[model samples]
Target chain A: MFKTVIRRAGKCAAVAAAGLMMMSAQAAEPIKIGSFLSVTGPASFLGDPELKTLEMYVEKINEEGGVLGRQLELIHYDDVGNASSARNFASRLIRSDQVDIIVGGSTTGATMAAVPLIEQAEVPFISLAGAVVITNPVKKWVFKTPQTDRMAAERILTDMKDRGITKFGLISGTGGFGSSGRTQTLEVAEAMGMEVVADVTYSGSDTDMTAQLTNIRNTSGVEAVLNFGFGQGPAIVTRNYAQLGMELPFYQSHGVASDSFLELAGSSAEGLRLPASPLLVPDSLPNDDPQKEVVQNYKAEYEARWDSKVSTFGAYAYDGLMLAVRAMEEAGSTDPEAVRNALENIQGYVGVTGVFNMSPEDHNGLDPDSFRILEVQNGEWKLID
Target chain B: MLAEFLQYLFTGITIGATYALIALGFTLIYNASHVINFAQGEFLMIGGMATVSLTAMGVPMILAVVLAVILAGILGVALQRFAIAPAKQADVVTLIIITIGASIFIRGIAQVVWGKEYHVMQNFSTDQPIEVFGAVLNSQSLWVLGIGAILVVGLVLFFTKTLIGKAILATSMNKEAARLVGIRTQMVLMLAFMVSALLGSVAGIVVAPITFTSYDIGIILGLKGFVAAAIGGLGSGVGAVVGGLSLGIVEAMAAGYISSDYKDAVAFSMILLVLFFMPRGLFGAKVVERV
Candidate 1:
């Protein structure tokens, strides 16, 4: 009689323990994050690395039991570097997926195209583009990780002023990125007391920029050539400059920060200078700098994982994702409004790019100091002292 | 200012040479088929892309150029036999759409073949620029000008001197009448596509040293060539030459003097002005409608 009673009690206890485990598993739902980028088109150079970086981090975070003890789920779409496609995907992410937060848009044009819809949806958006207009007026729900075009211009001008380059010739592209860069550069140039001797523009598709170069060469008192464009434009200008045998100091924007620029420009890229994130040359950074550790860690991990060099574009996405995660953790909720509040209050969070101090007034949270002026010496980037 | 003017003039002329060659190709194909082969630009792209790939594989430059031209010719013949001939029963608008579809299809194939990044070849001779009258011109530009001149002269002679050319011309004028006269209209049409493709590839090979080639390069070049052909008179070879060179010079002047931002607008605006005045184009034969 005693043995039968003990066996029945043991069976009841085991069944109750199994029932309690099932209930806990049902209560913990995964956190969903949505993203759209130029993953397979012309701008894939930017978006491909960014996507890889996000995947790498999400995997690592999940391996550590995720944030708030929930797994992270990523939903992404390839925008194909077109505005209409970006807008369509952005709408779908908001209406259909109903993700808690959104991140990405590799190019300036793609990012701007998705901004209006994202604003209406009231979801926290952290863009990976470099355009200043993304957060100039400050959307409550929007934040960007990359340094703005205005900030890049400011950095370039500061370096130029330090080098005593007073007269400048600006050759810009007719595309949206080039035009925006032109405006910001001109604004910064005027403020720095620099003289604009020649202003020329070229179509992005033009095979020959010699006509524009010739005009600039003939302009008097031009001490340096500042090219504000991307892709083959900068390379074409570099080739033409060398062909013309002009020895003027050459300055390019951060758009041509990748090693592909080096391969395209060949030997002509030797002396060109541009402002870029320290992630590009982590070894040259001082040991005491706060960003040095983060940049090194990211570069080592990414190159090991993908067998490819990390780009500032990828670093931007990394910073944005980490920032969003931190904000969510601090808010202790995945609610969009709560995340937005936490993000704006974020301060001195050291990311791979720099220390980010976000606020209601500033959505980007990065200043001109975040960029380091770098020069190409013997086909590799060297930190400019 | 004088040197700048010369510089712009030289650049314009060099760009105009490529445009002229493309316009000539447009003329030949349009004459034979009465269908605009929008895929003409893809022939140029294939030529450049093929040459680049072959040369990268250690093939001699001369052999690469010849092989690329032949390959382009074969693609042209295939395009006619497959894409165009099958759509013979379609209306004019449908034919145009078919050609557009063919162009896009060729571009897609090229993207898969060569990848999306732009590729460039070294100059045919030396990279040294020759100075003339305060203006500098690269040696490759000379090659472009030389070949462009030779092709123009060669085509004119072929059309006037060769019996085969006359049969092709006869077929173009009236396909039914030419068929009654024992001329094979289908053969003539195929020959037209082959010749046009050959010319486009030559232009591509010669100009690749100056302008880098990518899959998307075909779209703009095709539009420009079509515009040049329209301005030159749709069916006139000499008019294509004149129209292309003039368009180039005018565009360069506008970019140098007015504004580079409005350069494309200036070129297209000139075309609009000409079309507004001459409904049949400068060199096009006047056609009267019978109601």
Candidate 2:
């Protein structure tokens, strides 16, 4: 009987120890979040910064004891800036990785392609791309961190009106982004009582803009030139303006505000005005502004890590990840519906991009107020009022 | 209106000069090997990046340009030996696909090597705009046009007057016949690639300041250069220059007058029209094929 009792106690103690080990392992597992972006190809410039921003925020959150006492984990994949790859990445992240939430689509084409899959999976998605239709139809699972092209146009038109600019020359690329911006700008220009005197369109890769600029210059009563493009168009337009000796003020799309614009445009990009998010205005923003902190931190970390400058695309990704983390915490669960509701209810959350008050009706959560008109003066960007 | 038209013409000539340089490069290689090197643009990219990076590293401008050209020439030789020589007997379409594949592969490697940052080499001349005929033009544009003309004349004289150049011509005319006549055909092929790369780099170094270069710039420039070569009649050196200049002027006029949005469309359309009308190109001699 003594031997039997001793054997029974030993078996019980072993079982108890095994249970404790299993419990500890379970507790150590982190709450994983899925991320996808274009880390290569044409849009890599935008996606690389976004990836860096995501990494920085995830590190910060994890260092702060994570969200709701669970360590935050991010699983990132490079979509190579293609739509088909983005869709595959979305399905894999949702169905296989089973992440708590999915965030990021680097371009409008890629983001739009991934939406159906994200919706079907009933997962929350926040796109970093700036197409308005991504949110206009109001897909329940879709949200975006960047301001839409329409809002950018509204801001540009508002700035033009404030400056008493009436007659304009519009040059746009044949690509989707350019077309969308051109259409919106024209509509808003008409609404704002401005006349578009010349409408010139060019392909994305065309290096010479003198011919188009000449046509615009020939058009009667054109006071300003508004160029909508992503890559070489803005630089070409700026160069042509200088070449033609046109005295009209040149306005550029936000895409031209990257660090490479001045390098590509040489001296001609000086004094060029464009709409840009607050992320680029770190030196001008107030010290205590939340945006300033995020920008400063990102600049320091990114420069230290990659020896490169941060862009607006990076700012969006950083904000998206932070917002997602906050939502997860507020909901106190990893449930997709709860996180979505929390994101919709998010109020007074200041991000590197802008202040967010996301709601069911409005997914972008920011508008024209988020961007400031900036002028490139002596190879540096200066805020205009 | 005349001043504007003149200005467009001047701009067109400058760009045309650059295209001519690229076409000349294509012509040299195509004449020797009967193979189109699709990676010709990658050579331009490499040349631009090499100069920019070397200059940034504190090398003198002349030395940087020379080193860039030499390096690109070496790369051209390597590409031909490794990628092209193996498939010399392949069909025309197969050769074209191989060259294109080589182009993409080179571009991918360049991106990894240089990163995807736009790079610019400082202009050999001052960047101040010069007023010529009531229109402003960069001093670099004048340099590019002048250099392009000099290189074309130099190439023509070399091919016509030099013994080695004669041997190269002999090889290009008939590879089997040249070999039977004691000419080392393989060495001529390597020499062709080297000369082609040198021409491409020269163009790249001259135009880098005006256009700026990224890894992605190669594809468009290469395609346009190839188009210029085809339109000019592939094997004719003088024709390449004329063809490139005309194409550039036509494109500028089309963008200026008709529609900027369809400038590429106009260029490609002209190519199609030329191919349909003049199958042997503008200067190519018609050859009878025997089955």
Q: How many residue pairs clash in each candidate?
A: 0, 0
Clashing pairs in 1: none
Docking quality band of candidate 2, CAPRI definitions: medium
The digit string of per-residue lDDT tens for model 1 on B7-33 reads 888888988888999999999988998
Please provide, for model 2 over B207-250, each residue's C-alpha lDDT reduced to its tens digit, 9 standing for 90 to 100.
88777777777888888998999998998887789889988998
Give candidate 1 regions above 4 Å deviation: A1-24, A307-309, B288-291
TM-score of 2: 0.95
How far off is each candidate at the interface, as Cα RMSD in Å? 1.4, 1.9
Query: What lDDT tens digits, residue by residue, belong to model 2 across residues A330-385?
Result: 99898999999999889878887788988889888997877878998988889894
Per-residue lDDT tens digits for candidate 1, residues A137-213, read: 99888899999888888898888889889898999998878889999999988988887789999898877777888
User: How many collisions between residues are there in candidate 2?
Assistant: 0
What DockQ do the predictions score, one after another? 0.51, 0.65
Name the TM-score of candidate 1: 0.93
